[model samples]
Target: MSKKILISVVGPTAIGKTKLAIELANHFNAEIISADSRQFFKEMQIGTAAPNSQELASAPHHFIHHKSIHENYSVGDFEKEAIALLSHLFAKNDYVVMVGGSGLYSDVITKGLDKFPNVSPDIRKNLNEILKKEGIGPLQRQLKVLDEKSSNSIDLANPHRLIRALEVSIGSGKPYSSFLNKDKEKRPFKTITIGLQADRSIIYDRINKRVEIMIDKGMVEEAKKLYPHRILNALQTVGYKELFRYLDGEWDLEFAISEIKKNTRRFAKRQLTWYRKNQDIIWFDFNMSKADVFQKIDKEIITVQNE
Candidate 1:
């Protein structure tokens, strides 16, 4: 049997990942499965910068705006669905493209997730209540006391992540990080990881430009429509969260826009930090032309297949 290949285009937000992935998919005549966690919500198109209708029409893409903001979709859910979709796609095409900036989601599909012990619902509910009443600071402190490793690694500001670690630590009497990388499920295919990056200033500039374009393209309107659901986990992401403050009386529109740009740059830095740990990835300048990138990928695929 021929070896199946999965090409993953990974990078910071607004680094032209979607365009590269589409071009690669078209070149390889393969389907695309998006790994962007924010782009999963159907109601968050403009804010999420999901593929427009023309881009969607250019290639067959899956998991783009496939779920609603009201739906609770987890990383585990994406891993299962994406792997299953890859299985089906592999039966027809030898190559498929996976693209996004969500490192956790990509890691799940490529390396498999660690098995975690189930914590009681009571613990989770209580944590949620504490978050609502007190706030994330309490939970962050609790996680630091219980599982300092996870507290340092996870987004401490994200209540959902902090509470998740706390619940597992308090309920199972074990640190959540202890479960990671214990047992990785082996997949049949080989993944070619291509990382796109630019200088810090260039990346920040791109992010700022993208934010301005998003605003002009009606991101505010989209956020307004979803403001009622701002409390949902799906809406807690970078772009929407900053805009939600504007919708609320918490910040002025100008400040909110500036905040979005600043937060997005921070998010991109975190993404680079995560992706840089893997030494196997072949990095490319984000400004590279499509032909040059495609040629490099083709050469890499050939090299991998030859080995």
Candidate 2:
């Protein structure tokens, strides 16, 4: 084997990405590295939709359930760890597959993470605290002043991203864009991106139904256990964040359920927006038959091997 191929399967939530990725991994005789930010934590299985053991048993996987919810993990950390894992896996197997909806995490591996100067922990903590107390509006203001270009392009509703941009701005006294737009670093492998796409209505319906299934699978109780840590950045996810409102008495049960569906649909939109920017992707519609998708993927792998 040439050891130069890494196939990435990416798409919006509940678009059957997991099932497809596993099939590709099997077809290529490779393992999987997850790019999901939430699924990194061990205690977050139900809410994060982390793969069950049976699914994992179908293929050797990495970076799933690898950390505690209490531990802090960043895109930089993911880049370092995932790359190391890839290097090790590629040493044994010629190719590997990475799959998830987290665009930043995938970018960290493919486009290369930008290097930034260190900032004191105090600045990050204080910015996070103020963000919690004041909501997204305050951080939005700071990020606009600090990096208007990137700020305008990002999801304004995501306070964690907004505040992180602010922290980088204040800490380095430079626009976050300065660091973000740095040149991409080279990697050894040839990347073959396979994007899963579907009709807008179908994707939205899947997202809504997936949220309901998550709740029925004990996501509410899981959120309750992590409510004390809701202020943590990792807990800023869609499903758990909405349920936290119910736990805090801000919304009735039915209202919270509705919010989860609405917010998840919004998340799927954001995900599509994010992935659309990557033109390197070879998109396959979600309606394709499983065997057909795998055949396409396997042919791509063999094509890559020939190169």
Per-residue CA lDDT of candidate 1, range 219-283, in tens?
Answer: 99998988888888888788888888888889999999999999899988889988987888889
Instruction: Give candidate 1 regions above 4 Å deviation.
Output: none
Score candidate 1 by lDDT. 0.89
- Across residues 1-307, which tens digit of lDDT does each residue of candidate 2 receive? 4646888888988998889889888887889999998899887899888888899999998899899878878888899888888898889878899999988888789889988878888987897788768877877877777789878777777777776777788889988778875877899898888888889999988888888888889999999999999877778878888889999999988899898889878888888898898888988888778788777766777787787
lDDT on C-alpha atoms for all candidate structures:
0.89, 0.85
Models, CA RMSD each? 1.2, 1.8
**lDDT of model 1, residue 275:** 94
Error of 2 at 5 (Å): 0.6
lDDT of 1 at 293: 83
Model 2 local distance difference test score: 0.85
